[model samples]
Target: MSQFIQLHLLTSYPPANLNRDDMGRPKTAKMGGVDRLRISSQSLKRAWRTSEMFKSAIDGHLGTRTKKLGIEIYKKFTEGKVAEKEAIEWAKSIAGVFGKLKGKDSGNADAAEEKETKKKKGKESDKNPLLTLEIEQLAHISPGEWDAVMDLVDKCISEKRAPKLEELELMRKPEKAVDIALFGRMLTKNSRDVSIVEFGEDAACQVSHAISVHPVVIEDDYFTAVDDLNKHEEDAGAAHIGERGFAAALFYTYICINKDLLIENLGDNKKLAAQTISALTETAIKVSPTGMQNSHASRAYASYVLAEKGEQQPRSLSVAFLKPIESRKYDDDSIAAIKKHQENMDKVYGSCADFRYSLNAITGEGTMKELLEFVTK
Candidate 1:
């Protein structure tokens, strides 16, 4: 089996803010001495991992990322008729096994202040008293760990007592959480038993920020909304007006997968690893960032895909666009440039990859099914 898998993709979007900056304009990056529209790696990964394609492809092998585990536990216990005080204590204990508990000085000031104000008014605070039981940061809990935690919760509820020390050994090597295995996670020491926190798994995949292959200029779309109930004779003006930034471009995306690390992270389950690779590949090619999607309706699939597999050190083919492609025949020219760059690299580096397969929608050279098989098989 190959040690690494690399993917180079070209996708085009039309007049959309696929990813945005703090100012609500499309994100941009300076590349090849020109402004290029950008979609961050974080945005890309989030979209792929959360997409229905990925979820359905690898159902039950996903992890939940959350900071409210304690709150959920507390609610479960209280709803099970456990005493408020007991519920709080049990939830805190269980949650502490995952990460540091939020303390009075650990950024729960708003909740604390609200509780005190309610007390001063001689009324109960509507906030759950166990709100502080939450952890300080988001914990990516594996499915196995989640199951263990839930089992302990059920046992505690049945016995009407707190979880025993042995029962709190919740952390487990990730075996079923495909997302966690792919993206990785880190868990800090919890408030309970500082020595019990397990180390995190390193990510098996690396993703690059998708950037346009050609120069771009952010444009503003000024528009208005007319109230449906308004009469044209009474008021000929629009009821609402706004402006938003958008851009259209062909983007280049790169991804590298450490196949060995992925299999190891999945407990050496080669079948699951292959399944994961297929799911991830399809999602990455088909899923679009959700930013301003409803307004812009910009969704796209990769027009060209190149998949390579080998033990040789992986490298991106982004240098192909160091000189932006012309708009006259941008798609075809971009594809030719990428292929030429690869050939040039092989001539110098003596073949950067052992094998490669390509799917060119413009020329209709390969099919998606064939590309998936080429990479995963």
Candidate 2:
């Protein structure tokens, strides 16, 4: 098996906002001394991980990433007909393991003297505490950890005792979920004694933020929505008018997978590791981030994909586009130039990679089966 697998993809998105910035405009980054439309690695990862293809391939192995974990725990306990108060307490306990929680029932004391006095007397304060409990940060929990927490809650309730802190701490070491293994998590402010291995394992995959191969000019599509209630012909003006940012460009995306790390993350399950890579690749090709998709529907697939398998140090072919692919008269497309540049650079750099496979849409060459076989084996 190869030590590393690298995928190089070129996909063209039409006018759409697959990723947005703080201003609600399409994201852009400066590359090659010019502005290029960008799709953040975060956006791409989430889209692929949550896509139907990924879910179908790795169902029950995905993690839930959210701060509303109290709700999940509460629901399970409540379904078992556990006392509402008891369930809330146990749920909060489990939630606390992931992060600090705040709520009316939470034992936290505020700075106010009156609240402190109320807490001292074991009395409720005049100000109502928040009904909902929330974690300080979003927690990524695997299904296995969730099950463990549920079982622990049941055991404690049956024993008619409050959960022990030591018991709750066990949840910190969850079975790694596929998405967590690939992207990893960092609990910088964790208050628990969980080891690095128990919390955020090192990410086995590195994804470069997808950037346009050429410079891009952001354009606005001014649109309006007409209200159906305005039936009269004299009601000519639209009900709402807004402008949205959009762009069209061929994007270059690169991703590298560390085989050994991935296997370790999956608890030494080599078969699951291969399935994960297959699912990830398929999702990347089939899924486009659904940002303003209802309006623009910018669905696209990779036009060209060059996959490499090697034991040598991994490298990206992005330098081929460092100068930005230019539009040429004889060869209008940048694919040829990008491919040529990669070949030339590899030759100059000792062709560090051991094996390579390619799939191009234009010539209808290269097989996905062969690519998958090479990467997995």
Q: Could you say which candidate leads in lDDT?
A: 1
Model 1, residue 28: what's the lDDT? 95
lDDT for position 227 in model 1: 92
Q: How many clashing pairs per prediction, in order?
A: 0, 0
lDDT of 1 at 111: 69
User: lDDT per model, in order?
Assistant: 0.87, 0.78
Q: Encode model 2's per-residue lDDT on 85-173: one tens digit a residue.
A: 87777777677676655433334344476466546534322242223446656778888877887788778767767778778767654
- TM-score, cand. 2: 0.86
Kindly report which residue stretches of model 1 are placed more than 4 angstroms away from their true locations once superposed: 104-128, 190-192
- TM-score of decoy 1: 0.90
lDDT of 1 by residue, 1-377 (tens): 54999999999999999888999999999988999999999999999999999999999899999999998899889888999889988898888777766552323447668567546433322354655676767888888888888888888999888887766764464475998889988776633364355647799999999999999999999999999988898798999999999999999999999999999999999999999999999999999999988997999999999999999998999999989886778899889999999999999989999889999888889998998898898
